[model samples]
Target chain A: MAFEFEYSAKNPLYPVSYLKLRAMHSRLEIIWTGQAENQAQGLAQRVEQEMLAMEREFNRFSEKSPLAVLNLKAAMEDVSVGEDLFMALELSEAFRRGTRGYFDIATSTSCGKDMVSYTLNPKSHSVRFNAPEVTLDLGGFAKGFALERVSRMLSDEGVERALLNFGSSSISALGTHPYGEWWAVGVDHTKQHGIVAKEVRLKDSAMSVSGRNYKGEYHIVNPHTGASVAAEELILVEGRSALVCEVLSTALYAAPKTEREAIVSQYDGYRASEILCGDCGSVSIRKIG
Target chain B: MNRKEFLSDCGKIGFAGVTLSLFPWLQSCSDKAKQEVKGEKARIGIIGTGSRGCFHIKHLVQMPNVEVVALCDNYRPHLEDAAQYYPKAKLYDDYRHLLEQRDVEGVIIATPLYLHAPMTLDALSAGKRVFCEKSMGYTLDECLEVYNKRKETNGVLFIGQQRLFDPKYIKAMSMIHEGKIGDVVGVRNYWYRNNNWRRDVPSPELERHINWRLYSEYSRGLMTELACHQLQNGSWALGMLPEQVMGSGHLVHWLKEDKRDVYDCVSAIFTYPNGVNMTFESIISNKHFGMGEQILGTNGTIDLVTGMYYSDEPAPKGSGMHQLIAQIESGVMSNSVFAGTSWAAESSPLAPGVPIMTNVKVVTGESTVGAEADGSRELLEAFIHATITGRQPEKVLEESYYATQFALLADKAMHENQILRLDEKYKIPYTPLK
Candidate 1:
């Protein structure tokens, strides 16, 4: 893995800013600025450290790692894991149930945890499970959540200008630039294709856009019926936190109309604007707050 | 903890688990078959068990096998109403406290709009089902979060979409679908009630949080509270959600900036997929005509207001095909039958026989056409039955979520005042649908 940084913003809401990006099989970018920029860098390093640790314990692609030891131990019925991995396991269980199996973390092509389930070892940082299922894909929002934890740490460490983007469609912003209150965010409306919707101005917020329409293709398929959400092309939501946005964008796409608005309203500090395109080529946009 | 939950949890998962909801299967069973084949009753607890809560409570009380075990509200007076129904049920002043009750199975949260999401998450996490009132929550995240959480929980959820349950709406939808008014091409929805509701000032702070539907904090103003319902109606009938919504909102009659953040009147146009457009208007200042959908189709128009369906009774018999046969018979033929004919002998170049559809009666049926069928009632009952049966209904979550998704689009369309795309992402940078 390699690390890189830059400061590119076109909305004019931000000036020269620092963006921390790391490239591996996938990409991870951490964008931070303002009073907390330096501390945010350190937090990014720590997040990288945690990522390494998690990879060591979970990565099946790495032969030198102790993952085989943990799996072999579980084969003989013995193993353990730390709190973060354990909580992730529990959360995974909740997510599977909550989404009625949508947004599944265990179903990725590579790096998904299909083969093995992580078992806990209350005191030690060690991990063990019955067997290797498939690769563990944190590509969804696990890495994003890790970045969120890191961002929180940066805030603790006084990193004022902090913005982090986890490769898969997730971003975390902390304490806007030295000049503004909220970051400027622009999105394309779903119907009037090629038209910009409202410009969102927010701070200490996380905005996540799920890929129902990416490069004009719907990458997400409803896990329930094996068909993609019928009309949702793009959904732009802004709220107090990205975790909420991360999970919401996933669920709202599959949500039924009767419950869509009510469901969107169930999160704190989050608002969503949806664009739906159908066979007729007419698009409709709805904003929820 | 309340007495009933305390006892139930004490009997089931023990003290630590009492804070969680208890599955109905844990109840005592008489026959062994009862334990295996039977499902648990849909348990429910209501937040702000006030006027609306009381109304929902009445419904729950009558539904067999279900229980209304917990009631919550910050105000003691509101709690009193629910307490009257479930005297022994737990009562909570802090709404979140109700989230910990073990026996509570589901929830009917009709609280102030601002508290919608916080209360919803707490309930969903606590493992209780939920039924939130209309206009869902204050922000998009909250709405989407509740939606996602509901999906995550796979719990039975119902929004207070009364029109979704109303017979009037169901019938109109079917008539349109059955093509009672010909192939529907356009529609107009209007909801203009003369009164914009009245509320007294209990206190300064209460104005913003309490009676919130009148303000922007709890509701999306008239668009959310009024137009959203009808917008849904039009979408259901037309078989598509709007992509771009651009409209104007004006607070003409009652204007109080400090107390309300919503416009009292909204005139909007939503463009649908098939190029069918719906013009929706809601005015609080003066309700001129009324509320209903005018679906313009190829044959005729379906008026949802009067529960009527009309069409220019199929064009006069032979008026169309007769002209063709007649023209052939009177043709100034050449020497042979296969020879070319002249345009001169044609039926009346200036005034042709009832020129196709132009000749069809503009008003085929009487001024008042079809009568009110129980279609709307059937639609409502279908939704209600789906909730009762645990069987996925016709307008399933996948269907309704898109509807809410559409409502959201209309708002953006109105805000941007330009035709916008429908599939907009939450916040990662986007390149629109078109």
Candidate 2:
């Protein structure tokens, strides 16, 4: 039957390439250019849907939900419990291993309470926590994991060639975005405006930069010294997944030069780069892959 | 009553429980309790009062609460005609001169595409609203410049994307958003007309400029003239911009390309963020007429028919025939048409033709349509409302910029035949269209 409108696909139908997706999510304007139209729209829609879904799934305020019940049950055993916050718990472990405890998810700072004090529980799709002294702040890595989830969602939707950027910095370039090479992503230099420190074209992975360059002395809080870690400047990293990029970028920034790579290598697929403030008017670009 | 007793009774309440009654369908509900407050009319001026300009004048005059106050054209004939049609209206030859006049509030530019950018920039600088016609400009840089001027000035600039004003597209877009067809996977916008890019009387000298759509200097061919509008419709509805765009076309059976640098069959693909790909095709060699967006979603594909002859909003059911018969009967009695209806089958009131399919039932036109078609009209009203009461429309300049940027990117792809990168924020900043 003749459809009311025409649903046309472009790319002139190439043999194989990638799909791309982008948004005004992260601090930087994001671009997710990829191949594979067979599942582009469906994939993009699902990514958005699931990102919002996870946010809802973990929100601790809903008292009637399974998360609340699990939180209450876990809290009964210990006033401050960390029984089963899967994404959060795993993030904490990765942070512990990657940062060597500087950016610890388990440790609480002046911002809120520690992960150990985050009375929480999870049963697969659900996670709950008791009224906490420590605020469960997933801001550091949630955006990246959300991006990783989006990447998987695109794959599940049959989109092989895709680039999904959660925000400007946290991005997962799934397939080669039509260039037959890695997607070219520019890392904005911290010191100046419109300055590009480096541009890496990535494939089959993702990259993230959590630095103190622009929003100075803001996000980074060093647990080891109980002082600001990334507060001075940018501590950036890239990886095969969101969690790795997030934790490595955070942990490696504060760790002594000798301990950084060993700490970051614990994760499966991750590489990192850093630019720190120097006394001699010289800035460095360090890559760990 | 006790607290529980009071709460239980609240569940069974009426006006007091009015909100509770809406609990079941709260997420997806429609309300007919609209309070219409009659607002101020939109003021409009027409520049380049050619036939198209006159038509716009006539259309605006017919619209409620809108007044066409001035007409501008280089040609004296159109200026004279404007005076005849609108006795009290001001007239000018140079659009720049028209911009200086305080009598007109906003201007409609139906001039050639090249003049659009400058005219609009002048109008915006002069603190007047603008509604300029399609392809909006001759070059990507020009389009960016004009649009940027609008933003920088914070003046109102509307592109005369009539399809955006057309009801068929609006309805289809609404349906697409409602997920009626489920996560739309693909959208195709195509326009095909059977006409050689040739002269009717073998006058290649003057013919190319008259049918401006035939040459590149004056236009971007089918993509800019026809496909630009359709592509905008797809990209806007999909809510994503295409990163890369490429075009492949041929002269086919048209005039030689030595004189005319326009394509007869051109198709462009715009891939959005989530891999939702939109394809725009324009073929001039065939008459089996077609133009509209084919949106393929997860549920069922929706087709947003727009801007073509057959693509008119699906006419209202039996109301169409009733209106047609009334017209035919009036025509016969009045003796207008040369083609006799004796050979034509009598339209039946008993068994009227089947109604056409569409995504969401929507109406078209600036007043009834969208902000893109009449920026200041809708936008001014909403802005005034917001300023006075702290409430405004959900969409804004950023939204329009996305649509504008999306169209230009795809156009650049067609023009350069290479994948254009729009990675940078406001990468190709120029003056605004407004």
Candidate 3:
């Protein structure tokens, strides 16, 4: 599935510059408008470069990646990570705690440890595992972190209008579309033939989508149970920060339907919804804040 | 360190690392060099005032450093039509007369396929740099003759396989070399156009002259006219010529027309030295598939036409917990892991085509040529730059020679019904047909 960053010169004064690239086995698009031509171009290039760097550092598939190296040595001894990896790990820890362990990153087929087994040293920018089984995978948090960073970069570059989409799952809108009042994003319902089940309009906001892994099996493995999430639920989170949206979306999807509202209420300026896919192909959408 | 300082340091390291690591080799031909060359103008001439010749004029007129000084064609109508575009250019009915113009430093040959070798030879012999339209010649002998002449005259020869200069293609090739897609295993290219492949003739005598592409004596039909670009791309991407070729062609749908001797459809498979095979298909009866080239590497597939690529393996995804986070964020859910053990069932995601040229914004709807046709303008610029600077484009002759050789051999393989290997004897001894 290829994704394109559609740019329009409809308003020449605010010409859009967009680039689409692949990273983390997903399509990422960055569209920037309302800046000087050269600045917009530079920001787009910087965004892509940052995303690729994050992929190189965080991707577990690459054995040479920083995350893989950390996963290898963190279990045995304290592993001093680079500044970027350390920050991402810190955010992962925060989300893991904030989601009450529902948003664990180590509960994979390869690494199955919860946040309690990991300890961070802020002064050294290092992490150590309390248990030998503890392993770190930043795949879940990387895109969100990258998006948030890119948004900051764009904003720093004085880009007043831009849209950063990391796959269809994570999106950050800075300002608004060149022509429209707000950056409108669609929430795709995969079970419903990948239709636009919901539309979100944002100005200086970020949104993330998490639900049915394209694979038919339970991809959302519960850290507490070590079992895959069986509930067919679609979760969407809109918040001021992409990382926050991503964390809340995943936590709510894994949390029971009754607990979703409570989980979302904990975060200010965060709105979430769950689309439950019933066995009969029926969908139930419940909104929460 | 604080979060802000850490983040800032990380961003700087990443930006520098990625920028330095990628595309180090492409730094040789910098925009500064192009701008330097663009400062000077080179006077050029156009021979064979046909559709392609006129297209060259259109792009040439737009170029800053190129002045179309002369136009030549035996056909009066084509000459007149081209003359309308460059009214001040010295027009001539004979190409030899056009070559005689002392001010014409370079010539763009977009005549019939059969005329490529002779026109290029004349142009080079006249001390004018040549940009000949592709399928270097009608036969192996003609191609060799031109290749030898280029070496003998020390003239700059750039064949019009525009894709060679296409930014998208250059970028794609760079990615392929960078192992972004791993090793290229195979290539599949097809050109499908729904047309009778005919041109209107003012007189019966002009039928053969005007529609030369449909005649075996003047052209190799789809192989030379259409498939050469794709074949050139395949060879370029593979960085080697085909060792052997096997293929077939048939009149198929256009048999009712007696004037046309060339086949309407052709298909060939070329095996390169690395054991990689390139499959080419062209048909004039269908336009559904349109035209595109696919370079299938072990890791990914690049669609040269669309400027996009799809990976063979699914993108490196985050863990299940990552998916759960995303699910919660999006407010949608279905099943857990949809990807089964069957790799075949899994679909790889498509990424936007990487830009071949750095520091150039790919703007859509600009008067600048579309991605498919931009090669012409780029090639023209390179040709003009070469003419003025006296610096020949790197590997253009060698690439052109191999592409033409492969094209002719593929046609031979199809007609003879045999797997033909490129022999040394074919490269030597330029035997001009009597």
The candidates' DockQ values read 0.00, 0.00, 0.02
Residue-by-residue lDDT tens digits, candidate 1, B1-434: 22232233223323222211211111211133234324655556778875656765665665455666788888676788779888988889876778778766667787765676777777777766666655565666666777778767766565555445333344445545656667767878876666646555567765554566676545677666656556666566666566666777767777753445577777887887777788888776665665556777786666655545555453322321122123323431111111000111112222212211111112111111111221222222232333344443323333334445455555556666666565455322212111
**Which predicted model would earn the best lDDT?**
3
In candidate 2, what are the lDDT values of residues A1-289, reduced to their tens digit? 1001111223234322222222222221122323344444444455555554555545454564333444455434432223324656556655664455656643343433233334223433333334343334454555666676667765775555554444445656667644355555555555542344566566877766665522344456666665665344455666677667766776776666677777766776566666654453446777664
Give the interface RMSD of candidate 1: 33.9
* Runs off by more than 4 Å, candidate 2: A1-289, B1-42, B165-167, B196-209, B256-258, B306-404, B423-434
On DockQ, the candidate that comes out on top is 3
Could you list the iRMS of every candidate?
A: 33.9, 29.9, 11.7
Q: Candidate 2: deviation at residue B223, Å?
A: 1.1
Candidates sorted by lDDT, descending order?
Answer: 3, 1, 2
Clashes of 3: 36
RMSD of 1: 34.4
Total colliding residue pairs, candidate 1 = 107
lDDT of 1 by residue, A36-117 (tens): 3454455556767766676664454566545444444544454555566556656664555554555554443222323224
RMSD for each of the candidates? 34.4, 28.6, 17.2
Error of model 1, residue B122, in angstroms: 2.8
